[model samples]
Target chain A: MRAAVCIALAVVAVAACACRIPEDPDGTLDRVEGGVMRVGITESDPWVELEGGVPTGGVEVRLVRRFARDLGARIEWVDGSEEELVDALKEGSLDLVIGGLTSKSRWKKDAAFTRPYVETTTVVGVPAGSSLPDDLDGVTVAAELGTEAEALVDAKTDADVRPVRDLGRAHGEPAAAHDYVLDDLGLAAGTELKEDKHVMAARLGENAFLVRLERFLLGRSEEIERMLRKEGRP
Target chain B: MTDRRETEGPFRRFELPEELLPEQRKAVRLEWLTLVYMLSAVVLLALTLGQSQAMKAAWIEDLLSLLPPAAFLIASAMRTRDPSAKFPWGFHRSVSVAYVFAALALLVMGAYVFFDSAFKLVTAERPPIGVIQLFGEEIWLGWVMIGALVYSGLPAVFLGRAKLKLADELHDKVLYADAQMNKADWMTVSAAIVGILGIGVGLWWADAVAAIFISLDILHDGWKNMRASVHDLMDARPRRHDAREFHPIVDRIEDELRKLDWIEDGAVRLREEGHVFTGEVLVVPREDDHLVDRLEELAHHLLSLEWKVYDIVVVPVREIDIPSRDGRPRSSAVGEEPARSP
Candidate 1:
């Protein structure tokens, strides 16, 4: 009986050691049990979306889901546009804004961005036989306002820019109004949105947390990329 | 019969001029050296990983995460190049460049660990040591530290041995130097294991101190080699003063040729072609009646120096002034006797 008691005590000790709260002196995990992680995500096609009234598919969505799992927390996804995602993150309603966010100095005040997982240069696509335009000028170009693509267009050309609400519309929209659509890595020279690389953002003070989380995520990124490749872009 | 042969018979001779096969053989050895270095590192690392207080075997594994993939990339890149119009020299140096890249990766890895540990040590932040039960014995990480030594040491020995052979045969300086670096790394890994064990025995600063020393050593070696490989790629020449040994042989050849009564003056210049030396000698012969036969014979004789000279070109100068001695025609002494190799 005494031996049994000692074994029981040792087992208990190991169990207790396992459960002791992680001394995250870095405060990497923003919330303990009750702390809700308000994750602001864009409802962009292919990369993120809401399915059956629950958080669903997209590259960033899946990436963040795995991150949440590692942090031992539940994610409450808040739907919003990229601009609204930035605002939600800034207003403190969201703990992290996940989507195709790129690192820009202008967003320094609103949200902190993680190290770039993928870097890409802009590419222009045209109808199979159509020649690619030399520049965006004298052409109808589509781009989301305040995006790197739009900034590139503004800096590189004198074209009459058309603002599009979504990436799909920007590419799927008729090219008669403009020669091309500029957005992130993909340019719709004809009528298709090309694939590009983007980033995820969170509030500034969460820098340490995001940095560590990014590193952890990057280590397991092959799996995340494999999942993305399996599920074609939305 | 022996005297007759010695006076007017042929000398038995064989010279293994490096061909495609021997070069390919050296390449294979280089690949093997790279593999041995990597495997030994993994094994030694596996041994010492458990000794550290914070980073368990798994953590060390994670830290070592990038080495294999980067090494694979370099190995693959070397196999991708084919002979092209733009690159007629072939991509032999690509192999050297790839090796330099591997060294750079190792250096970067060392730096990353050193900086991270130094910051932690300075802040007095003691990392949590995770204890695991192995083979029914409660083993502290001290054993893992010793394992690291074995992991780094064994492969180093293999690489050093192979590299010495490869260097002597192929005359590849980079591979030979890298072998020395690997030997040094074995010592570093051994030191790191000792430091980690010291930490396990309650000397907290031991592990970090060891890491700092190892990092500095790896950084210095890596930086020096990377710079050299880059210099070679830029087609830099050896300093003029440094060419003294070979310079004497070329000078003596020209001096002997000038003594020839039938020759006016001989100008010689030397250049390296791969692992051999080829000299272009300009001779102003007295007449052109037997010019072709004489120059060709002279070229053949110079190339007969199997160990030192590989190829020779003899250019006959038609019109050039000669310093007269008693109004006698000067013939090249070089055509009469061979120049000694330095």
Candidate 2:
């Protein structure tokens, strides 16, 4: 048994020694570092936004531009729906996709995600003079339609949840939105609801590129948070 | 070997002077050693329990591997106890009881791993493997996981080799079964490696695919052992240790019964109670003169046929209900007579 354990340990040592660092199968990191980077973008508020029919603004949009320059690569942006961009990313046509994708993104299984670069939270906030209630049970709370906060509010509280197209304009009324937007809408925070871990998508199996991108994004967490503070201003 | 006319049964018993006592001690020592090895393996496997389906399976298999040694050791300790008023048959059959429970665990755990991996495959759940830092270097977690599996799995190969040798010497089914399990460990390690490496190579489904195959293999082993042990519990004729074929001792004892000059024909039935056999023989007698003396001698003779024979009863009967060589219709098998020897 001792001899067998030793043999196995030796094999592990050899395997570990063979590659101290993990290598990407398609060499995405090497190719992108000194070449043009193809980026897929979609309109997601605060992370991505489209102005004049071109992808622009948002924290992730600006971060990707900086990431491209850091890699010494030129940037090219492609705009499409989440499904279309994800399919193209899977096909290796686009190196990265940014749409304020969260851990709860529907395309999670189909794409490789970088480590979460930033974490955002949803909270039920009320205008300053409103008395703070212990909980939202049976209390009407406005949550944005088609957002994770909407589902989180329903799951985490017995609130008389009302879905609206916009939570920003629901000032003075108790509502669930990104915590950063609470102060902008003149609402004081109350109940902390749920958190979202935001990440970027890469083609599956691009390990080195994913790690490099993760490192790049994770390094600027403070900057991402700072940029997020300016978002959704009236 | 001399057939000693000794009293030994549910009502009475005595220890046969074991010439292999030292060897038995060695076998117990070996079992304990194997147990320790598996305990360490279980720990190592637990540490590598990442999101990969294959690693999870390999961990479960190693965890299940600890059962055989435990059963064997407990049964050995119980085998030495004296019969009590509450349990006159003694603890000789404790191993058989343990076998059933061990088989049950194997079946349940194996099935769990199998279905979970298959579900992951069908649902297209990508394994969430990422990077970890080792000595200030960011190495992929897959390499560490695979390496841990190899380290955890390798010692079993050599342990299996050692157990194989001990099995031959001790003629122990438990040791042999454990050895067989160890031999298959390499296949599991290789399959898991393939799965982990597949993830590295861009085959997203490779980990799940490999997991399904590994789980199927484990489930097969579990099913086979479960069937065998359950049959043993039902007293389905004493088969060879592997439960593949009938033990030759049955035929030898029956032939010996027929060889007795006063017996016109004879039939024997035996049941395995762990390491030993207890049985009855029915004979058609041609003569009754000095029959009582002859009966004791024959019973003694049967016990000496093999070390596994713990006790035997020789009875004079009008006739033996010889089971037909051809398949008896199911209706007849359940007809008028309810109990018939297979």
Candidate 3:
């Protein structure tokens, strides 16, 4: 019995030594080429929008789909709030994140951003016929949670900023840009609040993925512009 | 008058032969590498703290682990210094002192981490891990933890393997102890990674469980090192290479002395001072004439038995004097008389 146990132990030791993972120096590129590229998205109109519980159309969706094809890989989409998506990107679960993300995202330190693909102005939206509040101090303004618009309102205005999960339920009025379609929500866009550039983010130190993404974006500028024009929004 | 004569007695200081130049050079190089790796581990661990409670524990272990290598480096450097009025035995025993100190540090760290982890397990306190937004996704904190473990573990394995061979060649207990600590580092780090990954997957108890296992392993090593070092400090009979029992060097020496034609019977006592032996023996000679010369020849022969037997004093005994009723002469009486060929 003891001899059998000794032989078993020897076999186990040999097996343990034999089975070791070879180091992949260029892990990001290897993952992108042979594994699923996880993309995180937030609900933003004209950039990433859901139609009947499926991502129907968006400039970001098309661009990412093309990039995945170029890498000979499949894409897995994860949807969450801006903070959740950014957190996923930083922790390396998601290779890329897209949702009309502004270049001024607070998570810049944690992840690298692609060059801006589009630029637009931030504006305050008031309920139709209500008129914009002047010298707005102590006014309660709602912005989509975890978005740059929320950060902008908090930093650039004395107004009491309320973060709403969905802007449609923002009741009376909220702040957003033209693409968000405040007019369709029975609200009117006020004076431009801030000029902002939109970009995608990737995990920090994933230089290969970032380089490929930047190259893809640079090559598809004309297509992106055309898509923007077709959507009838900046 | 007797104290003055003893002070001026023929106490011919013995010196072990210097190690081959190449081996000495290799040892120095190994120590430098160990010091550099230890410093880097400390810096990396400090930078990677605050990720989780497991991470904090790892950082503390790394901090405590630095003591052994640091002690080895200092002791090895000073081990060859000449004896002075302040230090009568030169600096050879520094290695043994370092071994004891390093063992103590390990024991303390092991006990502390073990209890702390057990407490955390009982409390079921979930570790709060923060996530960073990359590209547009929320990645869990597990990947960061794995990366930190890989960074710390790889260098430690390399350094540990490199030092172990050199420690053996040099017969350095302190270096050997330090090397063991470095070797076990990867196990702790890998366990921490698994724990963090488990917690990431919502297994809340895994981190503490892994920590407890790691601490137990460390405690086992610490206890072994402590026992060995304490035995050396007390001048206990040296153990064999495996350290399971007493070494056969003393027994072999006694046998050789008894086989000699001029000697009736002999007693051999050996004690380790760091990596070397310094002890005395009482030989009952068949005749008193030319007894010192015979013993000198025997002492030289015994020294050749093991290079570690650097000092041995052989006395010509008239009879088996059991003064203390233990059949063993007082070490103090035998210790004063240096081996001199008359």
Candidate 4:
């Protein structure tokens, strides 16, 4: 019995020695500083536009790029659908998700959003020669699936709502896609549907990344406003 | 002439009850296992902290619970040491002391948890929890909390169950108390898990509410253990589960004493010293010429019981009836009255 106890104690000591040292108490901050920051990006124009199948410059893309540089880390972007991106953020696979996401998102419970960097209104696009209605009483309004515009139309309008794959092509040739489709399709921009504050989403409780992004957005509001006017304006 | 028997202190090497050796060995083994379990629990707890307030509280409780098994292990080892000049009753009382100490530690921890959780509830403090991003997936704080609860809770249940039978067989109150703590530990962890899941579901108060219930359970266990250990330390006769009656061993001793011819009547007192009993027998000896020899025989017979009755002073006396306040004679039944048992 004595020998067994001695052996057990010795084993315990060795096991204790071999035990993993606890991770840094400030996990998110340490992770950010450890080199790679995984970012989830959805395909949205003027925020995360694709050029020849490669992600190119956009308002949010540039902002996050600077933010990543500030953290002394390079961004590793994972492209997915908005819901998939939010799910990835919640599962800790993505540090942050960007692509013109808004502060008021259905996935807010699973992901934390930075303060709004830009506020834009959802507008109805009609053919350029068509008369726009004050209210969508009998209009056939189209919104992309899973977008705030879909929710806004559902809540505020008694219109014949049509769920579309691409809002830009909803009023024109199905293959046509552009930054703002109203002019290209000879459609007219109509009444503002809903105002949304564009924000960046991060994994819930990734306070370090969220705070840093919020601070960067706050500090660079003027620069972002200029960038929006140049490329984000519609 | 030297009094050879007088040299035998209460600490003198007395044979352990033959049936208890295996149980004692089992108890030792169980304690070692408990120690290992607790050590791993501590490691897991450290790894799992900062997940949620409920998780943190459970971890702290786990840390505090390490005391009982450690005290039991040391006491169990020391309790078998032979009697020395300094400790006349041998080291058996070390078990009692360990029991009291362990109980006191539990009480302190329970009080701490109770107050801390109550204060949080009163202040309406919502603990801030973080999510860990794994492989591009955001895992909510609740999943981590569930993982932590399972890690800390499962082993406690096993250890608690493993120790209980050994505690009962050896009649080791300290080990029994430790086992009870281990049992309570898993329950506390479960409550913590519920609390964390509640937090996940956006019921901010659920965590504190669950914590309060956990604290209350701990406090209840603490009070019970403290009362039992304190009773043991005070040399109170060990009682049955009903608490109103003495252990059946006391009844057996009294019945056997009453059956003896020379022991016309007797009063038996039994008190537990650690795992054994030590007491006195006041016998109303019959008018026999060999009264001294009869008294010795009765003492030997009393000691021979399987109840670990290590010390018995057989005092021979004449019947003395006391009158009640109303002038009626009071019945003197053996083992019916309270007396000091050392």
Candidate 5:
């Protein structure tokens, strides 16, 4: 009984500890202020890329800009290679990383991925005259290097897969002239291709941030779909 | 000190036994001191009000000045009175009523200062000059007010401390309530200090605004104290074990009493009327004659605790073995009766 009373008191004390006021009287910021928001963007097409040394707009860029304004912070865009983006996040050089990145098993060890904003599908686009390999047995499928789509091809088939600099290049006319272009773009790309789907990809630990960005894009998805259709047209 | 035959006068006919310890006498003496201090402050404030000439000052003074005298007069009267025909519980409620009246007056004074100052702040085209002076020099009236507050506040702090001690010793609701009122005086004094500082800073409306804030605080405190006093007076069940020190002792007693399987469905209620613990155990007795003796021994064990345990009453309830419709004997049961006062 003494033990029980002591245990009860201990439980109360633990509960009291949780609710103890922080020594610093000032409260935690529900709204952010007073810092440069370092946003890491992979140099992927349409979503993010440097055009003439000026970082141009994309679905992710517009989404983050609004968040920056609300937070009273300046947006410092840090463009990097896909691997460097993850490296920058790990090194604490970047607060966030955004691109057409999917939360796949391969990236799980490196970075945290936010919830999917959009779903994409895997599709193969061959030239009008060229015979396409259905099984991808001996044929090479062109995919963006270090992408989830490339990983899927590596996982699913023993096909000869060639890596492209970007998915945009893979889905372009020149790359399409080669074997088959596995269009590993977002669901918008799939709807545009009408023959395939693309899985949207994001870095890790950004589920809420990605969800918010995706919702914002989803609100203006029609315009984005039109742009993707125009950009990726073979 | 007076003869018993002269009891018809405005004095007590009965005397308490000389057996009361020195500490108990000290408690009574302090209670009297609390009354006297409150009354004197009231008289001083009242005279100050009468002596002032300005319309606003005099009016505010008249309102603010009534609290201490009223509280003292009524609480003292209640303390001295005998149990009457109409009120079987005597006029103990007079303390609460007196506190209520005093609190109400303080609230009014606070509000008056708040509103009057706020009005001047908003509407006055020109800042009013500090006109009132008490001595030969042009004494800063605000400073004088602050000084008066300090004079009232310091004494009240001591009085309140003494009253709280008295309340603890005698289990007195009135003195404790007065102690609460005294706590409010500290806030009032603080407000006066700020008000004076604000005046010197050329924010002529500061004093009044501070008073208003102070008033609201007093009102809240007054309402709470009154509510508590009323609740206590209405024979509110004594809190069992809110104190930290006595909780372990109480828990032991409760656990021990509960161990007897035959003593089914009971609670041990403990209360502190003064510094003494008064406990009642509602119990179901077993068939064995030794059960009562054992319970008495347990009660004695509780009384022998280092903490103050004045009395213990073990209320034994006979276990009625009521048979079910199918003629099966029921389990042991207990019910409450007013446990005999220890």
Candidate 6:
């Protein structure tokens, strides 16, 4: 009886291993590996930018280009609004969508999201060449109203948080803004505050595609940071 | 003064019949063991629940599996309690009550899961079970799920075998029902395996199909156990653990009573109170001399019949309507004992 049970278990194990490639629900892996890689894009600046109604220079654009080249597939970039692109992704007309979507995007329920490939950190920074405070305990920090940076500065530090319309016009006070804004606002980066994790979306049930895409993103974390830095520079 | 008997140290009780004490001890030990092993299985299956519909159903089933063992243990504590001022009939019926609760849990959850799986089939929901990162290597999550399922399922086969033996020896309906559940658990695990493998091979509806079968198994166990326990509560004749067939000892008691010189006819009426029997033996006496002494002696002799004949009374009746008592005509409760020959 024991040997029979052992034999049964061995049979089960062997049978499971037989499916070498966990078959995709929609055959996304087989189609996109050597054929047209259908990419949908919307205007989310610094990740995807529309130039003359076409997708042009952005960090995600660069990543998608490399991904397509590596898979030996031709890229077919379809430019549309976010809603249109997401609808297209639903119908399987588009393989993936990239537009600075976060891990917590509303589209999360409608599609499969890759693990956050990049985390954009927010920090309280002083203008360049100004002495960095040991702590923001007594400092006044300016952040855009109704933004995560405003909430972060209020919670993380004892600074007098000043909500502003924009940080573009320099407020001499330490400003709570995204780390990517350091060069644009001429601020020396300081203590970090909040993080906005950015992710890419794919048609749901395309497990093989999602896995491959996530693997690519995870394997080249540093490369993504480099592109993010260059693309976000104002 | 405190009264306690400890043949098996943990399954503590007071003043059980000498013959049945060991069987009760063995049943209690097996039940405790069931709780320990099932606890492990529930935890293991929970960790591997991942995202498979079949795994979720199996995990929930394992979680609920704790109910019967726990109910048995709790009822065992109450089953042997002496009759109190408020509850003058003793707590012997606790086991039957516990059996109903466990069976009801199975039936209700089985219905929910069955419909849930069927709904998934109708909606064509594709289960998105994919690869997971383990120590920097991507492994198929199905392998881990199946491993946990196998671990959860295999032990029940052996455990079920042990449980059925004890169930019969102890005359425990709850244990018998739980044993049946455990015996069929392997089918649930095997069906889940095929479902997971089916998903691996890109058949989306297979997991839901397997879940339907698993729920049906649970439902069948619940229905059978519910019917038996309800019959017992209704004061139906004491049945063997296998159901329908009356316990042979019920007839044996009647045969023992008829062989005496003073009895012209006798009919045994017995109802199960948990693991023991309690009812009256109706007899028509042939002689009046030494009648009281003889009936008392008969009751004592019936109590010693290698079973938990905990409470029985031999009454001298003018006539025992054999067909009525033995057939579908008698609806009298244990309360009416023929006024004890006015």
| Best model per lDDT | 6
The full ranking of all candidates by TM-score, starting with the best, is 6, 2, 4, 3, 1, 5
Cα displacement (angstroms), candidate 2, residue B270, comes to 2.4
Per-prediction TM-score to the true structure, in the order listed: 0.41, 0.71, 0.54, 0.56, 0.39, 0.80
True contacts kept of 1: 0.00
User: Each candidate's lDDT (Cα)?
Assistant: 0.51, 0.77, 0.68, 0.67, 0.48, 0.78
Q: Could you give candidate 2's per-residue lDDT for residues A96-128 as a string of tens digits?
A: 999989878888877888778889888887777
User: Candidate 3 docking category?
Assistant: incorrect
lDDT tens digits, residue span A1-234, model 6: 564375477546756575544567788878998999999998887899888767778989889888888888898999888889888887789999999999778887567777778889888888777775667778888988898888888888888888989787754558987787677777878878867899898886676777777777776778888787788865
Q: Model 1 - which docking category? A: incorrect
Residues B103-222 of candidate 2 have per-residue lDDT tens digits of: 788789888888898887797666656665578565677778887888777778887888777766655666677777887888788778878877765565878888878888788888
Number of the top-ranking candidate, with TM-score as the measure: 6
Across residues B1-342, which tens digit of lDDT does each residue of candidate 6 receive?
A: 111222465333453566767887887898899899999999888766765778888887887788998888988889877677898778889888898888788888888889999988897766666555678876767777888888988899898999898887776778887787788788888888877877776777878998898888878877887788789889888878778587888778877976786787777878888877787888777788888878777877887784566667677776554454356654432334554462
Task: Report the number of the highest-DockQ candidate.
Answer: 6
Worst 10-residue lDDT window, candidate 3 chain B: B1-10
| Model 1 regions lying over 4 Å from their true place | A1-234, B1-37, B43-84, B99-128, B234-342
What does candidate 3's lDDT look like per residue over B7-126, in tens digits?
Answer: 123432333345644665776677677677667776866755533556766767777777877786787677666678999766778878888988888788889988988987796554
Order of all candidates by lDDT, from best down to worst?
6, 2, 3, 4, 1, 5
Interface RMSD of each: 13.0, 4.3, 13.4, 12.7, 27.2, 3.1
State each candidate's clash count: 24, 0, 16, 22, 18, 0
iRMSD (Å), candidate 5:
27.2
- Put down candidate 4 lDDT per residue, A100-144, tens digits, no spaces: 887677876566666677676666665556664566677777777
Give the CAPRI rating of model 4: incorrect
Question: What value of lDDT does candidate 2 attain over all alpha carbons?
Answer: 0.77
The candidates' DockQ values read 0.02, 0.12, 0.03, 0.02, 0.00, 0.36
